[model samples]
Target: MVLAAACTALGLWQLDRRDQAAATVSTVQANYDREPIAYDPSLFDTYEESREWMPVEMTGTYDSANQRIVRNRPLNGRPGYEVLVPLRLQDGTAVVINRGWLPIGNREAGHPDEVPQAPEGEVTVTARIRPGEPVLNRSAPEGQLASIDLAGYGAQLDYPMHAAAYGLLASESPAPATTPVAPAKPAIDLGPHLSYSMQWFAFGVLLFVGFGYAVRQQYRLDHEDELDAPAPVRTRRRPSSEEEEDAILDARGL
Candidate 1:
């Protein structure tokens, strides 16, 4: 019983995980389905995770001189860097834009890989808001970071910055060709949680069935000798004296 209960508890835990994953996938789908809203920096003065992946549009000039790079971003199995450039708004506040990935050149030759420059003038950007990533404890080249840490970058820039990073989707720039390739949309795969739940439930059922079968077999074994033993023999008994006297009188014809 204890083993069965444990298996059942595990199955319930998996089921809960499955439900949570489904809900997350549903939320992601809904976020993409809705039309984009105009981005207002003040609306995100206090960061909210729910706002992540919300499509937004804004027009700003790129601060090319204060650009930063996020090291080691991989796309299509090729390692690269994500260019993080601050887009200066008219109000003097800045927001980090993840331009996209850039391939690494051969390191042995000390090859100076050139980073493509952002456009010269104000450009209207259509992008999805992404939550700022946590800072990892790793070293990189100067003007490069380990992840998207908005507060960290704000400190580095010595200026106010939006709390979230905007992932570039499309831009209307004078030099269309200068735009960096946009990152792919976030994945909405439901993952293996559902299958894991089913497996756990199967294990719980098997435990109960196996335990019952083992108990029945043990009981049958304990009574095996008694079941196979032979039956006891019986003997005939003599009649009473009154019955014998009656029988003799009848035989004498008196």
Candidate 2:
């Protein structure tokens, strides 16, 4: 019973995970390629989960001085860093932009080989909305960050910032001489959670089925043992002495 309960709980947990994954896939499908809207500062005042991956356009200049490299970001199985630069909009509010990925450097142990610079001067950028990442509480070298914790990044900046969310660069006009590898699109696969949930549920059922089968087999064996046992034997009583003597006299006379 304990094992069955545990299996059932695991199945339910997997189902919950499946639902969450499905929700993410739905969001990507709904927003990934939708028409780009002009950047609205109020839209980011409190980040909306449903708006993730929604494209927005804005005219801004990259603040290269406060640019940060996010450590431990890997792409296509190679270790790398993500280049993050603040894009100062016309309204004086800034939003962090993840330009792309850069491979780790051979000369330096932790730094990237070369970070492609963002285009200089005023430019128009099309970027996908992304919520700020949580702080990992991990440390990184100078000029680098452990995670895309926008709030923490904003704290280091000298100007006001939209810390609730950031942007995944889609495109920029007046392109730079070179750019890092672009981020890959989000996978729509629902993963193996559904199958895993079914397995766990089946296991729970099989536990009881196996237990019942063993019980039935035991009962049948006990019944067969009783039927195979021999029956009790009956004994005859000895004849009386008087009756025996009369029989002997009659035989002598004859």
Which number leads on lDDT?
A: 2
Clashes of 1: 0
Off by over 4 Å in 2: 217-254
- The alpha-carbon lDDT assigned to residue 197 of candidate 2 equals 94
Looking at model 1, which ten-residue stretch has the lowest summed lDDT?
105-114
lDDT of 1 by residue, 1-254 (tens): 67767867887887788777777677678776578788787544655556666777777888899998788788889877788888888888877878777777676321127677888789877666677778889877778888887878888877788865555554545545554556676678777866786787788789878888999899889999987899888987897899899999999996
In candidate 2 the C-alpha lDDT for residue 139 amounts to: 94
How accurate locally, in lDDT, is each candidate?
Answer: 0.74, 0.92
Q: Which stretches of candidate 1 lie over 4 Å from their true place?
A: 108-114, 175-180, 220-224, 227-254
User: Once model 1 is optimally superposed onto the true structure by TM-score, how far is the C-alpha of residue 107 displaced, in angstroms?
Assistant: 4.0
In TM-score terms, candidate 2 sits at 0.86
Candidate 1 lDDT score at position 21: 76
Clash counts for all predictions: 0, 0
